[model samples]
Target: MSAGRAGAQIKSFEAWDYVVFAALFVISSGIGVFFAIKERKKVTSREFLVGGKQMNGGPVALSLTASFMSAVTVLGTPAEIYRFGAPFLLFFIPYTFVIIFTSELFLPVFYRSGITSTYEYLQLRFNKVVRFAATIIYIVQTILYTGVVIYAPALALNQVTGFDLWGSVFATGIVCTFYCTLGGLKAVVWTDAFQMVIMMIGFLTVLIQGTARAGGLRNALDQAKNGSRLEIFDFDVDPLRRHTFWTIAVGGTFTWLGIYGVNQSTIQRCISCKTEKHAKIALYLNLVGLWLILACAVFSGLIMYSYFKNCDPWTAGIISAPDQLMPYFVMEIFASMPGLPGLFVACAFSGTLSTVAASINALATVAFEDFVKSFFPNLSDRWSTWISKGLCVLFGILCTSMAVAASFMGSVVQASLSIHGMCGGPVLGLFTLGIVFPFVNWKGALGGLVTGITLSFWVTIGGFVFPAQAAKTHPLVLSTEQCVQLNMTETAPTTAPSVIVNRPALAETWYSLSYLYYSAVGCLGCLLAGLLISFITGPQKGKDVQPQLIRPVGNLFCFWSKKYKRLCWCGVQHDSETILDNLETDTAWKQGTGLDGLKDGQDHLPGYNPDEKSYTNLASEKVTHF
Candidate 1:
């Protein structure tokens, strides 16, 4: 290693890096602008938010993957394997079942309900207060989550290429914001489709080249097994243990439910389909796409394990941060093969920018329709579009600032998982209760939401406030090296303490637990509390509640009845019957089969009256759920 050779290596790495990143930035921005202009007419409120309910299955499925696989997957998954082991891969298996469940059970329900924002269902099922609370939580959590996703890739790019990290962050955010503000959901979906292809191609290329360098698949597998990075199943039942088979199977399923079934960023894509069948097909296809992407990511990690066996980057100090391992590995590969680095960088930026655009689009829609419209009744459609675009710019700035702050935080994966756990659980719970448990009243739903959220936050932030039998007897150790070693081997050393501290404070594997458990906890909490409150407050005489209040619940119950053979006991036969009964009961029966079955000047049902106007006029407007 002469001085001349060393200098050449450094110079070559820098030259290739700049070329790759520059090419990626141009490609992403170009595609983004093209879609923005193409879909500009669709940028009005409804079209801007949900694509005017006209997206097809292929684009929707692609967008779903693009939305979920952020910079975290590109930078974090490989880094995870570089530090820990392969068990992290098992967390994805349960998601297969989750996709199936969502396609069959959840997507159809949302499509049939005919609502724009999922939060709108909360309003109909419970009250305005519940809807507002859920919406606020979603907006806040999404901004934070999207911020971290955007930041991670920027950090990786900066470390490898010496680009200004904050500058990269600002550039990515502005491009995403501009496109989303201009083209709305259509722009997001089309661009995501293009981006997903690039990401997969980049990942596959790395997997193949790294495997070849490590002496082909057989040799790579042998190296990984020797290095103790191949373990895929753990049967541990301990609650504190991360990435156990049981936890991955059960907990991972719930996490997917929250993400695909509840999260607006995902569900909005599904609902945007032109037909219910299209939505269901898109969702299932997304499952296949997700598995393919995860496989590519895991294979890449294993290949890296084989190639860098004796010289781990985290331990050798070649890379100061864990998340930089993947980018560094790509850079090293590019040192040998020139233009390949550009492809990988393009893929990474594609993932990051697509997610940002989707988040900004969803957030702006929620802000205008759900939050702003209530206060400013005089706001016109054109003004609403401008306002939505303005919010996108504002949020882009806020997210970039958060990225700057996150640069100083702990491991990228840990920070992201922790933030997701804190908010995802409670929100999922509220939505679950509203759809699944018809008896849950507003007061109970609200109380349950608060309780579940508080409990989840307490556990995540403070840890076991009072260590039970497990905590007192086994204090969690916080060593990064030990944690990494423990993950590779199923059996712990007899001499070491049973309670070893987990590195990253909480293992990234537990993130699935934190996210998945929320829906069950929140739903159970709301159901119990709502039931108790309804009992205490005395059941509202069927006459007291609004007709629209019963619409969503009735549809949910009807869906369950047809799918699961459950009988509804709320004195309504079909969804239509429920709406008609409520309209007659409230004297709000103006239109005959109106938006909720009370149509104008005609009451088709025998018992329904025709003069009731108690229900709000907005109920008459046709609501496109997608």
Candidate 2:
């Protein structure tokens, strides 16, 4: 039911194409080597994880933009928009709100918390058990998905362009491992900045060429309009409707918040900034790059429609799967141009490099900060650095092994991917409960996390047991008039588009809800269950908890709960202090952002020297938190 190629062989790569592809690996590897030598870690592991808290806003912002963008976005977004209507483009409407929430509510807390792992906040607010559980959830989810991400795309690329399947997979995995192991976080962020440039150039090339071939932008729009693919508004109130305004916009906002609001990679990058103001500026700048890329994806979808308006390649059996459409189109159009196809391939691989590298780096940070350091608090700085490097190398190999395993799975990969996405809502719920609602205790948080994940998996598993009818989720009209097929002649377009219909039974209705709303469902479940449990078990006084852990929403709804005394909003305490804490008995390297928000007595810790600049020691010798 996916790609079913007709007869013609796909064009193979030329010499210039190989050169372009080779440069991507060389440039990427070079960045890692440069940083690894310049900022060699002789003391502790802090610099390896967060760039010594001295990274500039611009490069870090670019890295942030690249880290979240996977091959799925580069390959799948166009295919998604091409198959469905342009209403999918409305998903970005909520992405703006995602950035706002991360900057205002989440980023500040992580930036000042003095913790390396994002899950460290979970421990600080709730308990170590909660932190370990969340860390485990992240580890499992990231490893599984990362492997599938690298494998499936390599397989598809091989089928279309004669690229080496196992070779590309192993090469990508090892090269990423080499650089990340050698350079640490500085290498990851700098390489990401470089890779994103290649990615953007590739996107621009596709858009400009495709538009020119289709006559112009206006003509492309007209073609898209004729095929009923130019729609952006779908006001249908039905929950089962895919790509509706409610589902794509409202529901999507909630979905993205789970990622931008609390993902570990995102938190790590923001924490690397010199100041909170720099973090804010970098985040806002990141929106520009992200939105630009998405716009290309959506616009490129229209260009795909323009080229295949009458032919409908997938319908004509010229291509097998919707996901293969982009690869086919690239080879089909850019073959004669030589290096253009190579550039596109490099663009796709850039996505692979940035995403996997970032994941490996995060896994290393969390593994050491959450698991290793907790058990062995007395380790020397040199030993801690070695342990951290060893963890990075270990994760990189595990990820590669998982990629090898991915090649053996069939439809199970999709199911695994869906399960991977399901865990995010619960993770987001854990952070939201701790940061937004103070009355929710450790027990409430643990219970809510379990309840949310359970409900999410139940609904998702039910979906697999009884899949929806194909006709119910059909795409708009597509004609195959121009394609020269064996049996069919003329355009095949007699059938009307399928309309949304109500299911009869309760279970059927449950299964019918669109995947877009999954995050909302899980989040709401967690919040509601957590609130109920907190009230029954005697919620904590807002006054008892520190305000830095809580996001100050208003002078916030203090009157909403003080009368019942069920929940009370706390007031924030702000004092004047610039991070300059020195430890003589403890250790000190580059002073981290953790020392940023110290209070009256705590801010003025002993041996506070401002003239020292050393990377041979660590201040977190005890792994202390304020």
Candidate 3:
């Protein structure tokens, strides 16, 4: 039933194609085995999680880029351009600002904290309850996300190979989990680095061949322009307009913020570097890699639009889903090219594997550091490493099962955004509240978290229950004039359906908001609710709040600050008071005086204690957050 449109001349992969696809699995698993053997003796939980904080910046950077751009991006982007327009490609506009903002402001806080799990910062900044809430939210979000990642490639492979959907799911899921469990973070990062290369090669091959087959890049662009698929920017201010300038450029920034600014998978890479400076350099390098990868995807979209401008598979009903178009196009064009289709399939799964490996590894880290370590304070390093590996296997199976559930969704791309907004937005809001304003106590943060999460679900789920018809839009011009002649035939274009479907007034308005704004709405909701509740319930005194929780700069409204000097024209003076206070605390932690019951009397934890043989020396010259 999951097969492509019935009897639509589906192309099958040849023997060479299977060889290419099998190589990807072999290479990925081989790398995992290589690291597992090399680090067998030293593969402690710390090593499994952060690569012993000794990873080179280049691979880490490449890993971050690969993780961020998953299979959904590679396939969904072209489908988006081909079906809708180029406006969705504008999501990358916020990359530079995000890199600068995260490197200068967010990275310092996390890197300075020396925490393996991002949720650990929640405990450090707030309390155990808040930390647990964040950990649960993160786990749920990642589980859902991993399922989508798994399903994307499986879905694509099914279209190309006629492979069973569950078989593809199990194959990809089991293979990724094996490597992640065996090799840990180093395997994930190095494999990511290798996969990034394969990904680019795959896309470049498609771009060159597809564009040339479409009569060159210039001709493709002209055809796309003629068909109205080249509109890059929509200046509409309407929130319901899916891909407006404000939606993608402004609202989309928060989406990236949730991933790049605070997500565990990304930050784990940042912290795996030798120093905080190396982390920042890796982040900057990731910015370049991110843009390059997105550019290839976007350009491939234009080429797809041109190649399909005539044939129009969706119009001909050759493919039931827009998501299937990418694979179907690959088969239509590259079936005769022997292994090229398999390479493209490998490229898709490379993105998926890297992302899932990073998530599973991070999920294991959080499980051990935040969940298991708290309950069992005296867990030995050997046992802790095994437990983390077990969790990786457990979560991988759970995610693979969830992929079976995700098959019902309309579009993987949209499902992903909804999940991200529902969870990621509120989490980002909690971190933002903690970092920007030191007065928010655990009560306020918890209250805001609950409120934001509830509202996000109410809107997201409500839209699902009471669907509204999407706004009407003109379909692109099409002709079978240049379509590749095969068993297919030209068909008359169908008439447009009515756009306005009658629905309850509340449901109509609620469903009108674009998915891009989901993160922004959740973030703003948390900030406002947090501040309001803080004021009502009596916020913590400014002096009582730890200075480490507050960002070190941008107190422009505080003219009477005692610790910092306020400069004119939106500038901020550097403050060393927080660093000094933290150093004093660090000294206490080192001396075993206890961190005021930090980690529930686990202050002398394996990774934190300066006296521990395994703890790496992370001390460096302090720099201002400005």
Candidate 4:
């Protein structure tokens, strides 16, 4: 009789959980649809992807938050905490500085240039080869990054609710594809704003509830400190130590500099803002939000330490994998809260979908504007928009498929970061060369980009291989799994700690050095190579180059000088200063008529007609610096 009663209770709980998950899914889907309809009219070509250059500061910042959050934050942060303690938080310090620098230094240049795609700047700075190389790197990186983001949430939801993982991934992808194809940047940004709110609520709820269950915030902190989970700084100089103060501070800054300064996803958001000032404000706001989120995530991890002190997930069989730690905690918290799990799922999906949509939209913009139009000269906005939409659908499907495949790869977080590190450096290098070193020729930029990517791959793969071999030959070196499992024991398990001392295997410290460093290295490599090649190839004459190509750089540095006194400084003969001054005064450039107004006046230069052709004609001019 007692057994029967217990079985009945279990069945009832299971049924209730199903109801909650289902209701949450339906409501979240409705929210997405509602936003899609609200932004339906703005779903035109350039506007759909770039938000028509009219997105406000708040929405842009929120969109950025959603993009950066991802399943990585929800799933990876807990897993990292479970393994490495609080030192991982140091990664964000450099990121904050990078955001400030990128906003102050890079945003104005992108805004002044008036280009939709960051790759367009490559062509202006160097040659088409650099642009093509950068675009390919971005496309590859986007697909991989988006795939992992999609996979993280799906993997978590699957373990918690027993949902079909691939099906969940496909469902999320299809929804994102439909809305992104229909609505563009506005839809993505607006939806992202809501998503960011949902994610914070979900995270905060878990933190508060877990802390309450663990006997309050003070107890949680006390327990974390006792267990050594509260250690936030590691000042060791060993390259193999993953979270050292120097590595995270110096290495992390370079990583974020590549991300904020050079990456397309980040730049696309900044460029979509209404004005340079608005973009700068959005970036600063994003920094604040990012710091808050990291703090919340770190606190959540500490709370987990208190709650799970008696029975760790890896040891108890509640979660077989480290990444499943966050989901397990979520399930335990929302077990009694009706409709909350659904909301959480929606938030997770929202983060994944917002990121996917942004990438797809950006990828489409790059493809149509950079690659397709180069070959097809007579493409219309309508046609180009359709092409981009079609590509979005195709890429969305491809990414979903990749997400399903990601399950076979061990450790989703590590794989994602590694992929980023491998490719990110080279792309960063190529862009840096174009922007900072004006004299680098196409050949040098191309060679440097290739060399940088190749070197990064060799170093990364070598690091992985050497560690694995050393671990097998000399059993003293601690493997990544062993390091992660160390905290699972009630008391720190007694093992020969000296086995890891000067062992041949790669240390956990070096694991953090993945592709995040790639961009900085690639940028340096490209600059040096480009300069060397330019020395060999010789410089182009000044008169042979177009003036508009260098206008933004000139304007930024010449702010206190009269070097760019003409509005038509780039041979358009319109006094650039006057046109820029008038736009600053009237803000007419926001309406797209600033250039059109210059068509019929003394502002117009011979053969520089806007209506005669698209901006690619400007690419023909040689780039020269005074």
Task: Please report, in order, the local distance difference test score of every candidate based on alpha carbons.
Answer: 0.65, 0.72, 0.74, 0.65
Q: Write the per-residue lDDT of candidate 1 for residues 1-626, one digit (tens) a residue.
A: 00111112211235665676577666666776776677765544556666767789998998898778757887788776655567768866777887876776566555545577888777766788988988888877788777788788787767666777788888777777776655667777877888888889899889878877777999988877876677778787754554557666776665566677778888888877876678888987888888888878788887876666655555533456778778877766556687787678778877788788778778877887788887897987778767877888887777766777676555676566555656776776676665555555677778777876776665555432222233211212112232123232433334655785534534333332333343444445545665677667654333333333343444444664564422342432333333322323222222111234333332433233445523233322432210
Q: Tens digit of lDDT per residue, candidate 2, span 1-626?
A: 11123235656778888888778767877888888888874434567777778788899889888776656666777877788768877867877888888899898777766777789788778888989988988887678767866765675567556868888787778877765677767788888898888878988898888887778999989988887888789898887775788887767777777777888888888888877788888898888888887888889888987887777777776655566677777776675788887788778777687688778877887888889988998988778878977987899888888988765543322333354446777788888998888788888888888888887767665665556555545577776776655443533446789986554474457776666667777777888888788888888666556555676554345445543333334322322222333333233323643655444343322323333422211223333322
> Model 4, which residues run further than 4 Å from truth?
1-44, 380-386, 463-519, 539-579, 584-588, 591-626
lDDT string for model 4 (323-438, tens) is 77777766666567756665555556667877887777777778777888899969886887678778888888877777866675546656676567667767767766555444
Q: Which residue pairs show collisions in model 3?
A: none
Taking all chains together, each candidate's TM-score versus the true structure is: 0.80, 0.85, 0.86, 0.80
Let me know the TM-score candidate 4 reaches against the reference structure: 0.80
Clashing pairs in 2: 2-320, 2-321, 3-320, 3-321, 4-319, 4-320, 114-594, 587-618, 587-619, 588-618
RMSD of each: 7.9, 6.0, 6.5, 7.3
Candidate 3 vs 4: which has more TM-score:
3
The best candidate by TM-score is 3
Full ranking by lDDT: 3, 2, 1, 4
lDDT of 2 at 77: 79
Off by over 4 Å in 2: 1-7, 41-43, 164-167, 379-390, 401-420, 486-507, 556-590, 593-626
Best by lDDT: 3
- Root-mean-square deviation of Cα positions for candidate 2 versus the true structure, in angstroms: 6.0
